[model samples]
Target chain A: MNWLGLVPFAIFSLLFLLLPTFNIVLGAFRTQQGAATLDNVMNLAQPRIAIAFWVSIKLSFASALIGCLLGFILATTVALGGLPRWLRQSTLTFSGVASNFAGVPLSFAFIATLGRVGILTIVIREVFGINLYGLGFNLLSFWGLVLVYLYFQIPLMILIITPALDGLRREWREAAEILGATGFQYWRRVALPILWPPTLGTMALLFANSFGAIATAVALTGSQLSIAPIVLFNQIRGDVLQDPQLGYAIAFGMIVITGITNLIYIVMRVRSERWLK
Target chain B: MKSARLWSYLIFLTGVMYFIIPLIGMFEFSLRKRRGEYSFDAYTSVLTDAQFQQTFLYSLLMALVAIVFGILLVVPTAYWVRLRLPKMRPVVEFVTLLPLVIPPVVIAFGYIRLFNTSSVLPFLGSQFGTDVLLSCGYVVLALPYMYRAVDTGLRAIDILTLTEAAQGLGANWPAIIFRVIFPNVLVAVLSGAFLTFAIVIGEYVISALLDRPAFGPYLVWIGSNKAYEPSALAVMTFAVTWGCMALIQVVTRFSKHTRTSI
Candidate 1:
């Protein structure tokens, strides 16, 4: 009787989440004629598809690594480094907004701030005589996308890791100090170990987050750039391959990568939670 | 401690600048419509445009539908799981998080394939049906935040005891849920609703693929085609997002105040 309450949610998830994903996975293993084959997966080995995957991996890796590092420093400053209390609250509140604030408006904001005739571009040129475009800084380039991705990625990391940092009790530090451990030694030996799981997990989460993002890249660079999600977007919109099964294969590949990364993140979160207990 | 505090101030200021500068630039650019001087011409132009009003209203209505459906679905399930099925938490959580991992384009693709004109359900059979599908997509996308907020709220209160007390008073399940459980978690539901509102308002991919006139795709349309108007739209979008976040803060603080006074 109690189990009946979950029926609606179960039906919703099965219809929307599980079945659609299963359809893609199943379609990836079939040809257009409905015959089972491995050609769809093999098509992923082509140079164009492989290069798309490579570019995506490089972007996700660079953004996640840099975002993790910078976010950790910022989170530490707010949660432990002892700024004003209101600063922490305001930062967190803003992080919540900035992290969710992606897609078209986000890209528009970046362009208004950094485009060739942008406000900052004009200011820097007039005041310091520095031409950002002359420095090869295109807002539509690969590195430019990373910079835009970081706008949200850093705050996401701060939001996720702040609580873990707060979990670092004062007693642990004092205990290590009493045991003749120096500050550096204490952090290296004690704090680092406890934080490893969450830090690594957050990086993995960020990797998956960036891997699946499409709108920001689309809005900023248009269809000219060849990121994984953009490739998938074009394929979905137009079936550019002329082979629907091949399109499913590309999406399946995306899911596989993000799924693995998310799995790692979940495992690490469980490990860290056990340590907390 | 003094040196550490100084370092904190330095790092915090740097982060604040990184976040604040783009917003300031967007606002300044939005005002630069009159050439060599700042004015509100861009804002006036955007606010006066008929398409802007149309798309903005469309997205606002869609956001409301998503919030209502999200609350109706999430609150009861969260309450029931807390009240009865503790073992189902992990399964429910994983399902909710699935939307985050799946890109919006992928989901929209799935919707196209799964509910096209020739499909069994045929959600895209007509414009109204397609709008329903778009709102459903928003609910799916916002599921993670909505479920987590409601679940966290449920956890804060004594669910089993409250339910039993309501039951002992001869109340039916619906009354117990609506009258008793709903009020207790109203704050959490409102937080989730505001977040959902923020997310659904500026969403582009799903609506664009579905060929809906959402504010998100309209923003993109202007962004590629217009000059200063895109900056004006950016400022407007940022203001809407900021307003939602402020409302969340106000709701949370109000809840705390009421809880303490009681």
Candidate 2:
């Protein structure tokens, strides 16, 4: 076999994926004149940059956790809750569409649903005399963004974790029940252990998915929201703070975080397959 | 047992509401263009606008290019890896997944710097060149989906034996791959292509930063200025996405039926 058959793929990845990322990393540690320096990375310690990172982490963590939990419930309901075959198929198909129904149009959909003059907002006010804005639920805040992010995040969780749920053998459940264990006990003892790896892996995927998202947040919250991706977006586009090199540092940081998350996801996936072996 | 059913029903109902409400709201808001009544004025306006047609057509052309280029790059590589370089499967899969981890903004950022007019490879030297670079970036963004779909398709068929059989019959490598293998996995390639279309159609970050007149940036522009028209555009975008996904379902179903009947 000519192993050289793999050359084109390698070169494409190098030119597109690895090289651009390497440029960011290399640029992160150098001055404009090419001298090696730590100033760009150090700029991350500035309160604003540090807060941007914190806010991003907090948003990703909240959204991923909520998405994972809700998606787990939805998937378990469809896959294991004795739903009909058509329901399962329809759910899967809808999840496929909704998960990809993200970015710019998703923001518009949410705005029409929950914005100040939204249908739900108007209905609540007319029916119960309660203002949604007065309830501190602005769709542009951190909580609001989490609410929007869950629209896709939960569907994504459902799409990924459904198979894992299916991988759960009925024999295990029957065996647990024959041993006089309740349904809850079967899940806690037999099911949760087997599912831990995939569950965690899916959560990490969700985290990275939301962390690197730029368009929906930018469209909904504008560039005013100090999330990491938006901050990075402005920096890359305008060098808004007058330091082009610091932009490289921020992009480098995003790569490191996402890479680490994905690495954990890969490790968990490998570990999850151990049971099958 | 009944309680479990009830719980399941409640959860499913809640999920359906969550998924459907935004779409309903967008549709309803779009119809509110006539003030205190319902009409399709907003849709008509968005459809008739010259800029909308231009940008939508521009993005559609870009989507086609990305899908074609993505297939050209992915199919052969996936086929070769499965047929010859089995040891390189892990490496190839890892490379495919790299695009998911890296944000589009970062990729476009790198392109602006690395392919600017002054750079050795000047992809941004002209407007046409910038469109090519933007489409290339779309290919990267859609790589994860395209590669995975094509790879899964390849795995479904028996490529190794087919290649050997064709080789023994005095067929050359290109003939074996194109004539024999390509037609077999055409369904899988079509599924991936539709998905890439969905992704490239409404993408905002890369095209916005690249200053392309694409549908995504146009949607954002309308959102900032117009009220009801943005909702109309949102509904239209949703319909397009649904169409792509439904086409995927049909293709898969058709492929399965054909396989079973044979």
Candidate 3:
């Protein structure tokens, strides 16, 4: 009976999650001769791969940092005293729905609203002769990916951090105040120390989430972009790479990055749990 | 102080505006006719077309199938973990979070590699084989939220007491499990199901990978090639996601138990 309960989850996980991952890892080393080698893993050091790798890391860090700062402030404000409980809950519900609200349609939305031919683009031109593109900020390039990623990242930040903030005891803040700690002094010495761990973990999770995403990036920037997931997507879809095994190799690269990020999440979660204690 | 408050309000309101403008823009674009006046022509086209109707029906049915799969896979483990396997709760929780940590794109590829070969897996050969595999994959993608909802409901209940009472009545395994346990977790399952419905209805990654013409893939193709109709399709998807969320709100409004997770 116990095995029955475990059986369904195990089978689904194996068929859907584990096997694909297994296929990706094993496919990485198999040569064209059907023999395994180090060629695929070693491909990470190629010049173009190096550029894509650097760009992805930079964009992810910048977006995650901006998202975390904005999310932390937003969470602290409502979770403390900025909004009434009803308002706070309502805002959160909206944010929750919107945060999970990305993918193909989201890319379409951004394009139609902010793209070169977008409505706001025409309006901004007439109003200020400030062509959005003239300003050299292409919403269809590297910055565009960041913009779309931020669409969800900030809300995710708010969602994950708000509940943790709800656990912050007001009495502690009051005690710090009574001890003659000024506002800045109190936050720096008290709140920052208490809040750093969860804030950091949420930041890491958001980075990983954005890092492994493909649809939004692909739809917005075109699949030819060198992002690892986009490359893998193209591979599997019969694009540049003809072999599905090569696609699996690309997928393996993505999994390694995500796996590393998730391991970081685990470590952060444990440290956050202890720090909260 | 007042000016600072105004500044903060401005920032937050700007964020809200940016978020909503695209949804409104899609609908606005969908409504405008060739005469440059608002009309229902786009929607009428979408509605009257046999392919559109078929795709929408397929999507709705697929959503339900995935939701049912979610309940079947997640409900059992969530119950047993909360009741008999208390020690394994953390491990169970960790497994549920796996889909989120590994992005959807990677997982979608994983499915193709694992199940694409007919010779390897006996079931990947036919249409039925692929669709069933797709639903199973959808369940995995939606697992974190669905399982969490059920687990939260379990935390709110005295599951041990419920199971023990059923056992004392000499109810067998299935009877005690279904009759006593499932009743309390029904709302959690419903909430999870609705979420799964939204995800599967709009999901493009897995469906496209599997080469199925599901709703998400339909929307993607329409959006990319045909500009005007894509806006109409976006409006429809927007309505569907919003409707699902609103439906859940209405259901929770009437019920005594409301579980909120962000």
Candidate 4:
């Protein structure tokens, strides 16, 4: 009787979530006439698809690395830096909002700030006499995308890692201080050992977050950038690659990469929870 | 101590600047429609556009449907898992988190292929069916947050005691779930609902691929077509997202206060 209660939820998931994903995974393995083949997955290694994956990986890595470092500093400042309570509260509230503020609107905001004739660009040109376009800064480039992604990426990192930072017991730091340890030594030996797991886990999450992101990329640079999501988006829109199976292969590859990163995050989170507990 | 504090404040200030400058630029650019002086022409144009109004309302309706559906699906499962199916917690959790692992584009792509006209179910055969499919997709995208929120809420309240007490009063399963557990976790459900609204309102991949007239695709369309209007839409979108988050905070704080008072 109790098990019967899960029937509706189970059926909903099976029909909507699990089945669609299963269909994609299954299609990635099958051919046009439904014969099993490895050709689609093999085509993932082709130059264009491979380059898209490479660029996506690089962007995800760069943004995640920078987001983690900057987010850690900001979170640490609030959690341990003796900042006023109101600042910490506002920072957290802002992060909660900013982390969710992605997709097309975020890209538009970035373009407004950094694009040609943008406010900051014009200000820089007028005040400093250095033209951003003349300086070879384009908001549609790879680094430009990374800078835009950082808007949400950093906030997500802060939201995820702040609790872990708060979990750093004051007793441990005081004990380290009393035992002839400098502040630097305390962090290096004690805090770093405990914090590394969550930090790395958050980096993995951020990596997956940006890797799976398509809205900002598509809305910002259009087809000018051939990141994996944009390539996938184009493929979905008009079958630019002329092979639907290859599209499935792209989606499959994304799942594999993000799946691995999220797995790492789950494992690291579990390990860190053990210590924090 | 002073130096450390100074360094912390400096880092905080830098982070704030990084986050705030884009918003300031977006607002400033949104006001640049008239060229010679700042004005609200961009915002007025976007706000008055029929497509904008239609798409925003469409997305708003879709968000409401998704939230109601998500609550129905998640709250019950989370409640049952806590009360009876404790052994299935890990499986339930993994299923909930699968959305985070699978990208929205992939999910939308899969929906296109799996539910096409030729498929057995054929959810994409008609506009109504596609709308249903899109709403379900939104629910899937939001499953992680909704499940976590409801699960956290369930954890906070004593599910076992509540169920037993309701049963002792001769309450049926549906009544117990709706009357007993649902009221208890309303705050969590509201938080999840606001987050869902935030996500669904600005969603791009699913609605775009499904050919829905949601605000996300509209924003992207305007962005590609115009300049100042995109910034205006961005500012408005940011306000909506901020409002959602702020409402979640307000709801949570109000619930905490009420609970304490009780």
The number of the candidate with the highest TM-score is 4
lDDT of 1 at B85: 92
What is the per-residue lDDT of model 2 for residues A28-82, given as tens digits with 9 covering 90 to 100?
A: 9999999999999999989989999999999999999999999999999999888
C-alpha DockQ for predicted model 3: 0.55
Candidate 4: what lDDT?
0.91
Model 3 clash pairs? none
Could you say which candidate leads in lDDT? 4
- Using lDDT as the yardstick, the better of models 1 and 2 is 2
CAPRI grade, predicted model 1:
medium
Cα lDDT tens digits, model 4, B70-93, are 999999899988888899999999
What is the C-alpha lDDT profile of model 1 across B13-125, one tens digit per residue?
89888888888888888898898898999999999999999999999999999999889889999998888898998889989999977877778878888888998989999
Give per-residue lDDT, candidate 3, residue B117.
61
Instruction: Score candidate 3 by TM-score against the native.
Output: 0.93
Clashing pairs in 4: none
Better-scoring candidate (lDDT), 3 or 4: 4
Instruction: Arrange candidates by lDDT, descending.
Output: 4, 2, 1, 3
Question: Candidate 3, which segments miss by more than 4 Å at Cα?
Answer: A1-4, A32-36, A243-245, A275-277, B1-4, B257-262
Per-model tally of clashing residue pairs: 0, 0, 0, 0
Per-candidate iRMSD: 1.3, 1.1, 2.2, 0.9
Task: Indicate the residue-level lDDT of B30 in model 4.
Answer: 97
Q: Stretches of candidate 2 above 4 Å error?
A: B257-262
